[model samples]
Target: MRIQRIQAIAISLPLIKPVKMSFEEVRNAENVLARIETDNGITGWGEAASAPTMTGETQGSMVAAIRHLADKLEGLPADDIPAAMHRAGQYLYGNNSAKAAIEMALFDALGQARGKPVYELLGGAKRMRVPALRLIGTGSTAGDIAETQKRLAEGYVAIKIKVGVDTPEADAERARAVAASVKDDKVLICTDANQGWTPDEAIRFVKGIADTRIEFFEQPVAAHDVAGMARVAAASRVKIGVDEGLHSLDDLRHHHQLKAALGASLKTIKLGGLQAVHDAALLCEELVMKVNLACKIAEAGIASAGLMHLAAAIPSVDWGVSLSSPYLADDIVAEPIALSGGYINVPTGPGLGIRVDETKVRRYTREV
Candidate 1:
């Protein structure tokens, strides 16, 4: 089958609560959704949440790239999704989020045509369910503690507490509250400084909480500072995980050589798309390291489903994945992803497995 049409939309879905990282606070999910239609009448859906700070992409760029590529994708054969990605790459440069959105749709189409789930398309799935870890913002310590307790009560066992937005002492206290709260439970806490701390500050904060159960430190230093990351990793007892730092294969190689981190957080938009994500996970495995397959926050069902399939197929993504769509005020899918006992059941149906709620998507669609 060949491509017939590609439709794209930009949606601004409000968050249940604003998510504040060290750099920006977002109240709504600025996401782009895409649907690819084949000549045989089968269609597949995809979504993207771009981050200028992380993926160096904005919603406008994603929409523009999708519109530009639609003309070129009209006749590409859908039997080989990787070839579709390569052809899409030829029409756009550096619009990974845009390309990722299209790749997701292509994979969805391929899965449906083959009567297999996207995970099965990647490789036979290793798991049928994946766990989600709720993230705590850098707003209030007491609030953060209460939120952690609330999520735990709702069956979440892992929480990522934001650090580095405050002073070293204050960040320690913020993390301590959540770590201490889970001390008696079978839960683990992770600290994500979002590259908000200096190497010295990261060392100090981790040392201060050295007695707590904080499992790992994520992006403690700046994204571009691999040397600082190495220094912080060397100085801290808690293992470090890189997020924004691993933007390219060379970046991964550099960090691996320095032994800067034990694991990395991979996102579809930042690395290009599923093909690139698969490559990165393999590289991590080559180094005997783990990877946390995560999505941009507030992604709609299409993006979430893509991540679930990827996490299911990749062995090194043993680190639990996060599905933040459930935390949104609303989702643009007929069947929202279900998270129970900290685990989300992967969709077993063909394509992304979740169906888009087009009416809701239209209501949430933002002006281009």
Candidate 2:
């Protein structure tokens, strides 16, 4: 019933292909995994895939924060997740990822103890299959066009193309090429700028693509520029979805007031953990804003399960999920979480349905 120990592991898992977004390119996923042990001998697993560019915490800082909070969590009841999050936040400033990691472990422990999946514990599932979207990296125009065609052929109806890595004209040309290559009018095309454009530039770039069938544009301007976001959203013909900007509930409220974003891209790690993400989803519903579940460039184990549960519970996730493909990793869970017909089946077991291969985790664990 009470916490006994908190163990943190830092692993660097190589990606099958280097993932490039407008803001950064990554070859390996560095994630901080935590396991919390209870006095009754139950162990719960969690992961913090912090984005130093986004959350201001790297793998090292997140692990240290988890270890620092070990004493405070030792005697606390694992079921009191809200209380734990409050205590962690009150004592440590800007450690959302660390708090999220621990909070996830607590939820996992409670779910396992009660013999229920995490989604049922949060709220019952709303759908059996969650729709997903594929991300096309910043490859050559010809290569990216081919990739988009390939993904469409593979049953991915929705595709998000990475832009903002080059000149506005160049990015627009690439997007136009991909849009043209797919040749499916029903396919949803979205562009992620990854906070790479200036407000004026974003307005111009998005305006150029306004005539196309693109569904929405994500994080075009800098993450902190709410005013710029408002300006761009107000001027652009396409709807805007904010990702890095709406990291917290307060941030969501601010964007709502500004009318800066028509949709929100919520990620498990960015909100700190699942509970925070759940709170955000509920808030978005209350505000009548569309929600989109996004992913960190983390391992498949926690990210895949967390996103599946999130997309299943939310009512208005119109843009689908932007999770990294688990199939893109050389080493991951024992059974691959495959995509079928552009959707993923929600897991139906205790806690997170997928089991983690501890041996594989150990093999990738880095010595500190």
The number of the candidate with the highest lDDT is 1
RMSD of 2: 1.5
TM-score of each: 0.96, 0.96
For model 1, residues 122-199, the per-residue Cα lDDT tens digits are 877988876687898839988888888788878877788888888988889878877887745567678888889889
Candidate 2 per-residue lDDT over residues 250-343, each given as its tens digit: 9999998999998889887788889888889999898878888877775556667767777777765778787674535654467656688777
Tell me the spans in candidate 2 whose CA falls farther than 4 Å from its real position: 325-327
Candidate 1: 10-residue stretch with minimal lDDT:
315-324
Off by over 4 Å in 1: none
